[model samples]
Structures are given as C-alpha cells and as structure tokens.
Target: MNLANIQDFGAVNDDFTNNSVSIQKTIDYCAALGGGKVVIPAGKPYLSGPFNLKSNIELHLEHGAVLKAYPDESVYTKSAFRQNMGEGTIWIGGENLNQISITGGGTLDGNGIFFMGDELHDSYELKPFETIDPRPHILTLVSCKNVKMHGITVSNAAYWALHFIGCYDVSIANISIYNNIKVRNSDGIDLDHCQNVRISNCHIESGDDCICLKNRREYEELGPCKNIVIANCTLISTSCAIKIGSENMDAISHVTFNNCIITGSCRGIGIQNRDEGTVSDIIFSNIMVECKQFSEVWWGMAEPIYITAYPRASHDHKDAGWRLKPGAKEAGIGKVSNITFANIRCKSENGIFLGAASPDLLDNIRFNDIDLEVSKTTEYQGGYYDCRPCKDDDFVGEQTAGFYMINAQNVYISNTTVNWGTQKPAYYGNALYAENITPLILDNFNGTAAFEHLESIVKKGKTQLEKIAN
Candidate 1:
C-alpha cells in the first residue's frame, strides 16, 4: 500500500509530452503492490493520451493540478468490450474493477474543441470519420463497483463526460461538469444499466443531455437500470436536462430525482422511451425549471416536462438508418406506467407535454402542486411538439397548451396552476388540453386558457392550430 507520485515514476508535468506511459506505469506499480494512492501533484499540467485505471487505486489530483488530454486522435485506442457503446475510444477507463475513485479538487480537461469541425450555424459539426466516431469519451468505467468521483471539474469532453456502463454502487458528489453549450453530443454523466447510484450536489452544463439513463440495445445482458437517486444538482443544457432512454432496449425502473434546478435549457425532466424498454416507477419532485426553445439544431423544444413514447426511426422516418428491422409499424411498444411529478415550478416558452403512442402505452401519471408559467422568452419558434427520432414527423405542430395530455390513461392533477406572460403569442391557448385520455382528473386546478380565457377548464375535441403544418 505505497503512496506513489507520478513525477517519481517519470511523469513530468511539462504540458507538452505525452505522459500517458509514465502515468500508466505509476498506476501499475501502485496497483501491483495490493493497491494504493497515486498522486498527480499540483504543478504544470500533465498532457496525456489515455490510460487504464486500476482496482483499489485512488487517482488523486491536487487542487491546482490538471490532467489534460492530448489533442491528437491517432494516439487514442478503441475499447475491447463487446457492444458497449459500439466499443468507442475512451480517455480514462477501468473494467471489472472495485473501489476505484477519482478524487481531489482538480481538473480533467478533454480538449474537446480540437476534435470538432467548422461551425455552420448553431453548433460545430463533428469531423467525419471512416468507421465509428473517433472522439474519446472523458471517462468510461465498465462494470466497476463501489466507485467514487467527487470534488473534480471535468470540462469540454468531445463525447460523454462520465459514462458508467453496467456498474454498481456508484457515488458522485460535489463535482462540476462544464461542457461547452455549442459542442454537440458532449453529454454529462450517462448511466447505462447502472444500479444503486447516488449523484448529489453537482452542477452540469452541456450541449446534450445533462444526465441520461438508458440500456443500450447491444448491452442487454447487463440487465435493467434501477435504484438511482439524484439530488441537489443544478443542470443546464441544450437538450434535455435530465433524461431517460432514447436508446433503451431493456427496462428502467425505481429512479428518483429531487431538489434539482434547471435554467435556460432546452428540456427538463424528460422520459423518452423510443425502443422496447419498459419504463416505470420514476418520480421527480421539488424541482425548479426554466427552459427555452433552441434552434432545431438541438434535440428538445423547450418543454419543461416532456414524456413521450415513440419509435426510433420507422420506415416513415426520412433519415432512417440502414438497419430498420422493426420497420415503422413495430417501433415503439414500451409501456410507461407509474410516473409521478410533485412540487414542481416551471417557466418556459412551451408547456408540459405527456404524449404516448397509445392510451395503454402510458398509464398512472400524476402531477401535484405544479406552478407553470408560459411566456415568449426566446426568438425561436414555439407551438411545435418535438418527437424527434420517431416514426412520423419529428415535430408535430400543435397549439401550445399549458398542459397537454394525449394518448394517456389514469392521469391525475392536483393543486396545479398555470400563468401566461403578458407578451405571449397568438399560438398559445388552453390551460389544459386533453385528447384520447381516459379518466383524466383535475383537482383544484386554477388557471384560465392562455389569451382565450375559455369557459371550460378542460378543453377537448377539435383543437386550434397556430399555423399550417410545414
């Protein structure tokens, strides 16, 4: 149990040399002697390509230390794990290890901008590659147990910041992720088929989903995603702030999020079931949300709370991939049930939406003590429902409603209120718009339809269109 320093093992912090081999040797020496601490001391930055993490080894970085990634792409290597995110390249990884922790209040810079291409408009397009994407993920820990990562700043990942696949008993706290908002696909904290995870007291800003949970198609043997708790976190993103499953091929359940704040994001608290995975027993409570419509370059369309079940790329999809085995007909059949949201507040250009493929596909949804306000907060166009990567149109041009529910069953709203801004558009209408819902209950609902002041609280039947469909 020796405390090894990287400098002693030939890792000089020159900021020009590829110190990956030196870092790897130091880690190996510590791990070979029954595991210990390896310190990247606070000095000049250490530029490195990639290295493997060891079991029972604490990779501690001092307060001013920075372990930065080398920009060159050819020095990186692909993963050996089968079907784990298509075996992508990774920066720091540990497979089948236990008690692996990355601690100390330092930074891990991914140097993501070096891997991007010229900017068209909203975002920088990724550089074209021959095979799979060559961008290295910042961190990938596969099937590791008792993992701890805290007091660190992870910035500018070309891909996902922290990806834990099929791992268990993970605890992440007091860390900050600052992925550039214009960098597409730079996600933060992706939990794929992980269990017993707790994430608290963190701040994340990203271009993609801040925190996403899914069970990918090829990783079905890892089992369902369950028992995740996230609290006291602030999230900002260009896509959904917190999301579950656009790539889920298995089941996800028993997830809870509380006391989180989202500001100026595209979407918040999204449950998107696009594949065969069934989603149930998810609860979000005591959260504040403020979202706006970004340009069509991003995934979401400003819904504060969006829950939808759609197929991933049906035959009707204009940009369908080469392999569409299910075709458009048998795309999304996952049942989403027992979802609840409580004590929430939202301010957004758009409203809350709960749409499903069928009435039976979504059930037992509840909203309690919700306060929502809709306003014209952005120049981006509103009044369109975004169901991207679906069988039909990616965006459905529906009239904006404070709370729109369609193709659902057993939905209950209690003590919820809605308010429209003074300078709202003509496209906004209806405090509660319902279509194809069974037994929808409204208890103590207090709000009028936007601009219309409709006499009926719950409006059904024919709807109003803001503009003609494109």
Candidate 2:
C-alpha cells in the first residue's frame, strides 16, 4: 500500500536510460493510473523484457538491484504470452492478470549462458528477425491468482528457474535458485496445475529437477491438485531430488513433503505417476539422503523411486483413456494410493525400486524408518585392483537388491536397514525384492545385504500362515 508513490526504475538522477524503457513506462503508467509499485532502485542494471504484470501490481526489487534479462525479441509481443507450455518466446510470464507481488532482496539475472537449446527452438519458429532464445525461463506463472513470490535471488535460467502453471493461492518464500554446469534444461522449481501451493525456505541447486510436480497433460481439461505443502527445502540435484508424476493424468491429492534435505542426487525420493492420473494422499516425511553419483542411476529414467501403471506404448497415447482405473471397468493402469515413506535415508549405486507394474495398480505402500547404503562403484570404475568390500564371495548374494516390489499390494517394510557396500554389480541382488506380491510384511527388517532367500522367506511365511490355520 505504501510503495511511496511508485516510479523509480533505476533512479539515479533518472533520465531513464532505457531500464527496459524505464520499466515498461512504469508498467504502462501503473496500468493506466490505477495500480502501483515498479521501483527497482539501489544501484542499477535493470534490463528487462517479458514483464506484463498488472492487476494490483507491486514489483519492487530493491537491495542493490540487478534485474537483468534483455535477451531481446521486440520485448515479447503478448497474447498473454503466445500460449505458453515450456515457454520460449523469450522470458517473463504470469498468465492472466492477478494480484501479484514479487518482493525483493535484489538479483534476477537470466542472461542464461546466452540461450542454448537451438536458440530456444528458434524463438518458437515465428521467424522474422528471430534469434533471441535463452532457454525460456527467468520466471513464469500461468493461470495466476493471488500470488506472492518472496525474497528472490534467481540465477542463470533459460529454462525453469521458477515456474507455476494453473496457479492458485500460491506463496513461494525465501527463494534462491542456482543453475550452473552451463544451465542445461535448467530446472530448479516447477509445479504445474498448481493448487494451494506453499514452498518454503528454498535453496535449490540444479542441472535438472530440484523440485518438480506436474500433471494433467493428456487431453488436458486440467483440474485437481490439492492442498500442497512442501517445507524447509535444501536440495542438490543433477536430477530428481524430489519429484512427483511426469504429468500426472489429472489428480494429485493432499500432498505434504516435510523437512527435506537431499544431497548429490540422481534419484532421491522420486515418484513418476506413470503418465495417467490419480496419485493419492502423498507424504514423504523427515528425509535425509546422500547418494553421490550412485553410478548415474540412469538419470534420464529407469528406476530411482520410479513407478509405472503400465498400458505401455511408453504410456499409451490418445489421452491414455482418461486414467483413473483402479478396478478396470473403464480402461486401465492408473492408481497409486495412500502412500507414505517415513524417515528415509539412502545411499545408492542402484538400490531401491518399489513395486507396481501391475497388482491392480499398486496400493497402500509404506516403508517406515528405512535406511540404505549400496555403495561400491569401485573408486570410480577403474576397478582399482578390484576393491570389493572384503569380498568373501556371496558378496551379499551377488550384490544388487535392496527393495524391488513388483505388482505390489499392502506392502510394508518397517524399521529397515541394508548396508552392503562394495560388492556391487550382479545387477544389484537382494535385501527384499518380491515379485507378484501376495503377502509381504517384513517388520523390524534389519540388513547386512546377502540375505539370499532370507531363510526361504521366513519359511514360506510360516507354512502359509499354517495353511490358513488348517
């Protein structure tokens, strides 16, 4: 309310030396004299493009301001930004006017290694002096509502530094995003089909997927992304530090990922709702992980808390039959119910792949107090005179297997621990790897790794529960 009668776009004896045409003529003279705040004072370097925020505006970037991003393309000729979706007509977006507030702490530079990725798809092929593509994101907000972005310091982004689509009562607090390694793909924060989103105390590091959750793309009439809350984040990812769905069909309910801290990730707490829909009450509580390059865990897909509902044509086309099938009366493969993974701690070189390619679409899965360490990449694959964590041969039963439950159902692995580092590569054999699950509940599951058959699965579950009590 008190933006002190706005109008100071890099003011220092303001002769308006093109601070992007003086912050777009003071935001078109405060939206034709009705709105306020466009001040970006305190030391200067304001070079903008693609900033079309209006309704109740308050876009101030104080504290030694450095709002730079003039990768130029006639400064975006809007249609509410030429229909966005991976956006790249060059920069800023907050689709559809809303009460916006982009707070300060100064610094929003997206010179972004000078727009790689085929010059941002040749400026969306609308060629006409085209050649200004810088990976497409310095900031994006689609289908906006009451939005608030706090204390920013967004770094090199030509792609996903911060993006929110189908937004709702959103609030992104204390943000700081980093995109080094030459900013390839550059994802640090992306939440599609957003709902009551609240991302707090962020410090995301990225080359890709530091924090992502997207849904509703197959025949999109998008709706259904409920009560979201992600707290106290500090992720370091080269990919997947915390992810959900790969465009969930059209439903991601009651979500809550509490107290996170993941390190050197290629996969640490990832869930891919196999491209259909319906991912129920999610919760990944009190996590702490450090899995330094677990042999690249196939970073670009293939097991790392991965899931599948399988109608496979690489997840069938033609709207995947509007997915929601749990008992198939209407198509198939879509349903990952009430999930919970409490107190997780992991260290992998290929370990941890939880069930469901079937089993009527994976149900009530839980793994409490879980712990893992399946090291042994052998001092970086030189084999270093074959250092195999004191190999005695059964090397944890051919070294590869911590938890792979396929076709899963009411599965639970409580109070677990599996530490078999340095006998890696019999394709990662087991600690608990079930197939065609019927009855699985290994409580107080302790580990040292080579549980080769774990006494024939506890003597065939005590003779099949005494043959169902005779």
Candidate 3:
C-alpha cells in the first residue's frame, strides 16, 4: 500500500509551526485516492490544532513521531456538535467514518497542563464554579464503525483520551495512557452508546475513571452501550478503575470485565445508575484490587466495590450544595440486577456498598470465592459505609461491616472470606450487614469474627436469611 507522508504536503518537522492544514491536505489527498495510510514520519514532532479524519484511512504515526496539540485555547473553537452537546472541542475527530484505524508506536500528546491554570497545583482545589478552561479531547469518533486503535501512547489529555460515541465493532489493544493524576476529568477511555467493543492488554493511569462505559444523556437517540468486553488490563486512577453510569439515560447490559488489575485507585469497580436506566447482566471475575483514599478533590470513599441505583436529582442534594425545588421534574429511580463478582481479592480501606432506592431494589447479586481485607491506613479514615442519599449525619461515627446491602433481593454469597484490621477502629462492627433484603443466601461464609457476629450483623430493617447447606 502506498503511504501518503505528511512531509510531502508542506508539513515541516519543526514543532513550532501549525501543521493542521498540511496534515488535513495529506489526509484528504490519501482519502481521495480510495483510502490509504497517512503517515507521520519519525524523529520529529508535528504540532497541530484540530483536524477531521476521513473514512477508510489509517493515521499512522511512525516510531519516534510525536503529534502534539497546540497549546492555545484560541487555536480551538467550539464545533457545532460540541456546542450542541455542551462539550469542549475535539482535537482529532471524525463523523460517519468507516474502517478507520490509528496504529503506531508513537505518541499523541495533548499538552494538557497549558489549559489547566496555576490553581491546579497539588490538589485540584478550584474556587466556586471556577472554570478549568475547557480544552479539546485528544481523539473522538462519532457514528463510526469498525474502528481500531493499537500500540499507541496517549498522554496528557486535558479531558478524555479516547471517546467513542454511537460507534460499533471497535477493538483497542496494547495501548498505554499516562495522564496527570492531579488533573481533573482526564478519563482514559469513554464508550458512550457504543456496542461490540473489545479492550484488552491496556495499561491506563488517569485522574478520573480509567475505563468508563456510559449511555450518555445527550446522545439518547444513539441507543444503549452493550456487548462490551474488557480483559487483561491494568488500571490505576484517582477515582474508580472501572465505572459505569452517572450519565445513563438508556440501558447498559451484557458487559464483562475479566482478569484485570486495579491498584492505587479510590474505588475498584463502580456501577452508579443515577438516571433512568436499567443495568443488567454484568460480570466481573478474576480481578485484584488495591484501593486507598485520595484528596477531597475527588469523589469516593476508598471503597473496593460500590454499586448504587437511585433517583437522578435530589439524591445528593445537600452534599452537592444544591436542591431541586418543589414540583421540579425529577428522573425516576433506575434498576440494577444480575450482577456477578467472582474470584476476586481486594485490599482496601472501606467496605462494599450496595444501595438501592426504595421500591426499586437491586436484584440477583452474587459474590463467589472472594477474599477481602479492610484495614485502617493513614491514607484516610475507614470502617464506615459511604452509601449516599441516606441521611449522612446518621452514619457518622457509626460502625460499618464488610458487606453492606440495603433494599436488595435475592443476594447470594458463597466461599467468601473477610478479614479486618487487628486493632479494630471504633467504627468497625460486623462482618456482614443487610437491611430490607429478602431471600439472602450465605454458603461457607467465613470471617475473622465469630458466628455470633454474623447473627447480630443486621443494623436496620429485618433481612430474611436463607441457609444454603454446603
């Protein structure tokens, strides 16, 4: 295949000049010739602002080649799609493209620090409603199909590194992402309303969620995010390593995460259905998690696993410093069911929290062959469940258990072990806690505490425990 080198199209190798037009010309020429490779040659950094990609084209960055984003807000103006979605500009994007791939052993640098002001020094402490100078994302693909990204290093993204919206048949492998941990909202990869995606052998370290799957509210017409597989990935984040929702207006189903590692994250796995959606048929297996608390800049309580289904507005109104007034239109509670976590090990500061809004219970959750250890570390305070929407003042200074579930049904636990700290904190109480749960099953559940502790673990409404003989 003939390659269309950008140098041939008046693209200088210097890093100072704006090479956007040159690259676009090269891409257009290659795409006009019935689709070929647009190659950026090695040993020089090409600086550009924003450019749209074409269909049936591979943007190949050779080894030692660097594609750096121009560090000027004036260089990027909001596009029509971005303005409609209330999002920032996109540096490299394509719409309605087919058979597009970005493959190389090079780097794509966003120069994100130039956008974030000096206020983001150690912690991301900003004033009230202070703007972070919204910058363009590194790469975005919308309404595309058969997309592939492999063996590239994406770094310093001001926002998300890679975003796929309303796309299908995607494969991302052998990619590495390094984003500043102090930066806000530098998510590694975001799959919104995308389907049939496979992500494997990736190492991601980000300031926000490492790998996030969402059914975005803005793109409701695109349908749900389903049939995704993520495996053999190592993730580290200031927030959750893997997350779903907080923006789910459609269904999210048939997602699996297998054989992954999570380290130094605030939360291991989180499924937060705050909007009107149904999350079901999710499986997480053969995973290792090590989590600790972070600064107040982030939202999380160092939980190993957190799942919740609640109303969209007024749920965390007080903590969020706002409230929905009377007669305001509010979204109904979502549903979460058929979630499985098996063959997992976790070392964390906080326990598992599973919460559901009244009349919309979490159904058919199961834990199998799990080992969890909770200890009080200097990172943050421990031994308390961080279930939201409930009265926050009531849980203060109260003892917490290993597994806390409220408003759930048909929960099963088998071959699970829980170990607490040697010197139990004042808030360390039980091994398992349940409230308003029906048909709870426990089989071969072993804990450091005695069997009497299990019998006295309930702290709220009655849970009908079903004995399962092993």
What tens digits encode model 2's per-residue C-alpha lDDT throughout 1-470? 43532245432323233355556667667767777777776565656666666777778788877777776545654422233323354356656768888888887877676555433321212222334332557777777898888997888776677777788898988878877633455778877778898998888877667888876452245477778899899887766778776556677788888888887666677766655577888898887766444232224221235444543222233223333333332333368877888887777565666544467677777788888777654333311111111112111222246665557666676887877675564454556556665555667787644445442222222111112110
lDDT of 3: 0.80
Q: Which sections of candidate 1 miss by over 4 Å?
A: 79-88, 315-332, 453-470
TM-score of each: 0.93, 0.35, 0.91
Candidate topping lDDT:
1
**TM-score-based ranking, best first?**
1, 3, 2
- The CA lDDT of each predicted structure is 0.85, 0.62, 0.80
* Candidate 3: clashing pairs of residues: none
Q: For all candidates, what are the clash counts?
A: 0, 8, 0
What is the lDDT for 239 in model 3? 84
Residue-wise lDDT of candidate 3 within 255-301, one digit each (tens)?
99999999999889999776777899999999999988876567677
Q: After superposition, how far is residue 385 of candidate 3 from its true place, in Å?
A: 4.2
* Runs off by more than 4 Å, candidate 3: 79-81, 84-87, 119-122, 125-133, 314-328, 383-397, 449-456
Worst 10 residues of 3 by lDDT: 318-327
Writing each residue's lDDT as its tens digit, candidate 1 over 379-420 gives 877887888877767887577888887788888888889899
Question: Relative to the unseen true structure, what is the Cα RMSD of model 1?
Answer: 4.4
